[model samples]
Each structure stands twice: as C-alpha cells, then as structure tokens.
Target: MPKQIRIGTGAGYSGDRIVPAVKLAEFGDLDYLVFECLAERTIALAQQRKLSDPSKGYDPLLEKRMRKILGPCAENKTRIITNMGAANPEAAYAKVVELIEEMDLAHQKVGLVTGDDILEYLEAEDFPLSKGREKILANRDKIISANAYLGAEPIIRLLKEKADIIITGRSCDSSLFLAPMMFGFEMKEDEIERIGKGIAVAHLMECGAQVTGGYFADPGYKDVSGLADLGFPIAEVNVNGDAVITKLSDSGGEVSLRTVKEQLLYEVHDPANYITADGIADFTKIRLEEIGKNRVKVSGGGGKTQPNELKVSIGFNNGFIGEAQISYGGEGAEKRAKLAAQILMERLRILNLKFEGLRFDFIGAGSLWPGGSPSHIPKEIRLRVVGRTKTRHDAEGLCNEVEALYTNGPAGGGGVSRKVKENIAIVSSFIPREKVIPQTKTLEVENGSG
Candidate 1:
C-alpha cells in the first residue's frame, strides 16, 4: 500500500471558482481531486431544472469545469470525485463521457454512484421535518425533491474498479475526500479511529479554500493576502490517516492554525459528536501543528459507529418572495428609510392585501440586530421591503409599493430596484440506513465518438 496520498479540493460549493481547480490539476501533483458542490437547497434547484429539461439536472457548471480540467487530469493521472451530479448522476455521467470523447481521451474510465434519490420512497409521516412539519405536510402536493445522503462505500467500490472519475448525487461532502484515503490505504470499515482521522482531514479540505484562508480573513485581526487569487487546499494523508493540509507553493492564500481552527468549527453543532453518513467523528482532541509555512499537520480524531438513520433534504415550492430596495442619502437617511418602510406598510394595509410574511429593514442601520441601536448613523441607507405571498401576483404587489416610493414617498430615495422570485424552501428528514441503497455504475468512452 502507498504510504501517502495527496488529495486536492476543487470546489467548496456549486458556484465556486473554476480557476483554482485548474491550478490544482495542473500543478498540485494530486492523486485525487474532489469537488464538494451540492448543498441542501442546491439539489432542489437542480431537481427543478431537471423537471424543465430531462437532460439538465446536474451542476450548471459541470460542462465548463470538465472541459477546463478533464484533459489535464487525464494526462496527469489525477482521478476526480465530485457530487456535482446533484439531482442526476446518470445524465452527468453521460455529459462527462461526451466531454472525454470530444477531448479525445477515450481511454478514461468514469463511474457514478446512484440510488440516493428516495423521493417516492418517502412518506410525509415517516420523519419529522426540520421546519414546519405540519405546514409541509399540509402542502405536500408542492414537494419537488427528496434525496438521501449516500456514504463512501459506493465511491470506494468505484475507486477499487480503477475508475478515473466518479460522480454522485447528494453524497456526503466529506465522503468524496474520504473514499480515496480508504481505497488507497485499504482501510477497513470497522476501524472507527482511523475513519475518524480520515474524516477530520476530509472535513478540513472539503470546503476547498476554507482551510487555506478564503473565508477566515477579517482585516487587521485576521489578515490574508492574495485573496483574489486564493488557492484551494490539498491534504497529504498518510496510511495512518494523519494529514498535512497545504496548498500549491506558488499559489495565493495562507494556511495557518487560525485558518484550520476556524474551518474545523464551521457548521459544527457539537465538536465532540460531529456526525456524517460514514461515522460519528469526535474532534474534541484533534491536534493541529504548523510544521511549515502553509502546512499544518492534523491528527488525533476518534469515531463511533455510523448513525442508524440518514438525513434527507426535501425541497418544495414555499411561496413567492417580492422585494424592493431604494437608497436614501444625507443626514437623516435612517429616518427617511424608516418613513419609506412605514409608507409601504400603510399602502399594503390600504390595499387589503395580507401576506404570509413581511419584513422591512434599513440596510445601513443595524438591520441584523433589530432591537439594538446603531452606534453611528451612516450617510446613506437602503430601505428594503420584502413580502412572501402564496401567489406571484400578490408578491408583485409588494414590489410595486416599494417602487412607488421612488416618486411619491421619500424625497432622497434613489437607485430603486424590485424583483419577484419563486422561493424554493428546504426541509430535512431522516430515514433508516436500511431504507437507502447505493450502487455504482461505470461509463466507458466510445472508441470513435469524438
């Protein structure tokens, strides 16, 4: 077995930058390049797209990204793993096959993990919803998509088959990175401690540049340079499941203990019991050592058995959201913005229009902390009025009222803008692991298809 392997993170989310991934494939000398693209609502959006067009449920940037890095990755022998398939792994697999043929890389082998989508298998009463369980059941007809999170077993099987690239739908984010380590080192499923260590490394690198200082910079307190050209992350994981997080030597971004710590705690509810599809990772005793510049060695993670139930993300058409914003400047900008909000409320009341939800905010004056007063007033404040309604027509009415403020209400209000959009809301549920089945399929490039 290999003593060590280098895995590079290509993306943190569906809309992450493409150039950083290109840099990693070209110069990172990576054995694996993993992209964690899907989020809770991203799959729902992809499902909506699939409903519109059968051939287009995958990541919108899938083609563009494959076109950019496929040739280089094939030439360099760097395998790729990504959940960019979102709602449709088979369609995504077909797209990649076409790209491989077009690029004349027919020798490449691609694999896809399937069966995560369990929309039909789910019942409204089976599991409680993350939000408004009763309301969601009441609006069950509007539900669009439901998908379970697959673990690394399917991906590991594909890797053992020597697949050069792997695509999946709604697989756990860290699984993409963990599969390579498990397959490369021939790790056992019951090795909870080792699995936990692998998970720690995967979590650190899963978000691409998060561990490399992309999201941790905070001006003077936490300064990071070359953020515009920030580099993605790479993990040099050893057979022991320990790893050193780093990046391309010439690439931009800092890799320090602070960055690693911030990423370690990101989105973690309880550090002692960070849960995933694979196993329960205990990060309470994880160690971080800055061994060299832009390199941090990480170890000491424990684990327990995997969760009995798998989490599923459900997407439904919640309602329509109408929003309008107008900026007011000068000494009394805050007061003017508030007055505009009052006018909007009065107008909506006069029209006898009742919305499911309504909100008014002064963008420059402590909108986030509604109860707190601003330390100082800003020269300009943007008044934003938003309303959620059952129908698009009713939502549009809220936008129209805000636009009217440009001429009738606030004297200094300018830069008026309005938008009405369908809100795709998300809810989470769980299903026993026995309910979901994951399997792998291999796709070979057609010999004469270019």
Candidate 2:
C-alpha cells in the first residue's frame, strides 16, 4: 500500500500524561496512535470497580483522554488503538461511540476486540497458581478477574474490516504496533523474521516516552534536556519491518543510542528470547544505528513460532494492608522513632493481635539500605509501621497502635498519617491457544451523523 507507516505512542501506562497524546494527534501525521494503558494489576482493580458499578470497569481516564484526542485524531484520519478498555471493552466501545457522536466525528468508525476474559472458562483446578503450581481453587472465593493476553490477530482482522478505532483488554503491548505493520504490509503469520523485526519496533516504542529519554536520564553520566516537555515516541516502520525510532521534530526529548539501549534491555529477561503472546522475539541480533540527531534505525530482530499456550493474569483479593507513619525531629530523632516502633510492637503484643506480617522502617536512617551504616544521623526521622492482616479489624488495630504512639509514648511525634487498603494480588497461568476465541465488533457514524 504505502512505502512506510508512522505509528505514535500515546500513553504508556494507565495514568500517563494526556498532553503528549493530544500533541501527537494534532501534529504527528501518524497512521496509527496506540495507547498501552493496561498493566498486570490494573484490570483487577478495574474489575473491582465494575463489580460496584456495571458501567465503569474501564480506565477512569479513558473518557478524558478520548475527549482530548478523539476530535483531532478523527480530523487527521489517524486511527486510534488502545488497551484502555481494561476490564470492559464493550462499555469502553460504547463510551467511545458516545464521544464520537458528541464530537460529531461521524467519519470515524470504532471497533472493539473481545473474548480475552476467560474467568468463566477457567476452573481453579485446570490452571494452577503460577508461582508454585498451587491449585487455584484454594482461593476461589477471593478471585476477582482473569484475562488472557491476546495477540494481534483480532486487531489485524479489525483493520482488514476498515475499523478506524480499536479497543481491547489485555492484548500484548507490542501487538498494538505490530497489527498495523502486519496489515499495512500484508505480512503473513509465518514470516518469522519480519514479525520479529516488527516486534522489536513495538517493544522499543511500547513504553511511550521511555524510548524518548524520559526514564533513561541520569543527571551526571546521561542527561536529557527539556524533561518537563518530553515528547512521546514515533516509529517510522517500512514494509521490510525495519523501523527508525524518533519523535516530533519540534518536541523536547533526545532519541539517542544510550536511551534506546536502556529501553531495549528493560523488562527483558533474556536478550535472545523475549516472549510474547504472538511469538518469541530474538532480540540478540537487533542492531541500532544513529541515523540522525533524534533518529535511530533499528533492524535485525528475529522471531520464532508463536507459543502453544497463552499466559493469563489472574487477580484475587490478597487481604488488607494497614500502614501508619509518624515523624520525629530535634536531636535524637532516630532514638525516638525506634522507641515509637518498639512501643507499637509492645502494644500489638499486649492486645494479642496476630498479624500475618509486620515491618518497621526508619525513613531517615538507612531504611532503603537496610543494615548499612549511615554516614551521619539526620535531625529528623519518620517511623513507619506496616502490617498485613487477613481481616479489616486486625488491620485497623495495627494502624490504631501507631496513631496512639503520639499521646502514649513518643515525644515530638507529629505528622501522623494512617491508611488501610484492600490488597489485590496477581498470579499468572497459561491456557491452550484454542481456548481463547477473540472476536471483533464495529460501530460507525455516517458523515458526522449518528
């Protein structure tokens, strides 16, 4: 079709900044703008919200983000792709439709990819816990959500159907970029090397600003300018599956070899084999060339056959975490904080409260480097006590003990703060490829008319 395609990364995570995405939509001249907004535990939290309100499981910022970029994206004919649907793709699709109607962008068409959720099909016995292969049935009552990581097949199908916007739940992050390449270049499933090259491009761009010097900046050794106005990444991929990583010319950020290398190694367990739902990418052979001031050409990635099974992330209620913090200042702050911690322990013991676990940290005195000698004692230190418990009552007791330290034992104990929250734990398991049946749905408006 076209000689090359430009894909811009909009959002890297669920809570990423919105301004960069808006900028991309307005001026990037991208063929596709992808938002990778789902994380391992985000869907689980969204599921909890869905249980409370049937129509609100998707990313909370979906509406705001869509409202900001939808009009510009539709005007520019830059198709949108996002996994922001989170736990509810249908509801997300409906919301997008409403936004389109409200914005009167009837020229745009929306599509949703579904069936990644397999909570109903999963039997606790069939899929054991990922950590120890423990039977999932043990925590059946607490399980909140289970979603499989779909690949690019369904997205490719949607593109073939000419869907302008595609929403999904838990699709592979790289697949968002790969789908367009596969569709635009007419690449077949068996094209392993080409697919791998595409995957390499996706992995590099998936984290948005990470490739553009956001996370890779170190003050003295490696430095990036204009951090506050950093631009998201854009990949100009060719039919051959090679790509050049760059950003908007007027944007602020550096796309250098150091930044690209750091991002390439991020979250990669093995350089030779980076696994995903679609296929296993061999990044060992990937080569990067600094083609311009803010452009790097990438090629030489290889791919193996797709995995026989797909990994699924399962979320369950792990219990509750109770935490409280109190600050001590003026000479001997460390001693006072330690005394406060001791008093908390003694109080918990007196109350005969049995917590699953407990931890005490002295913020100003080597909490991060535990047991390491501090060069000097600070004038101020904060004592933070946290505990995990099976029930809310037990958790509340832990927090209350820390709060009571102000009046009962410690001197100059101020800035007392306490919080209790339900802990959503995650586990992973795999299922046969045949088990997941991904389908697509389309919604369109005719010539700015609903």
Report the C-alpha displacement of residue 119, candidate 1, in angstroms.
Answer: 0.7
TM-score of each: 0.96, 0.96
Q: Summarize candidate 2's per-residue lDDT along 13-59 as a digit string, tens digits.
A: 99999999999999999999999999889999999999999998999
RMSD of 1: 2.0
Tell me model 2's lDDT, rounded to 2 decimals: 0.89
For all predictions, the C-alpha RMSD in Å is: 2.0, 1.8
With a 3 Å backbone cut-off (N, CA, C), the pairs that clash in candidate 2 are none
Clash-forming residue pairs, model 1: none
Output the lDDT of residue 55, model 1. Answer: 97
Distance from true position, residue 291, model 1, in Å? Answer: 0.1
Query: All candidates' lDDT scores?
Result: 0.89, 0.89
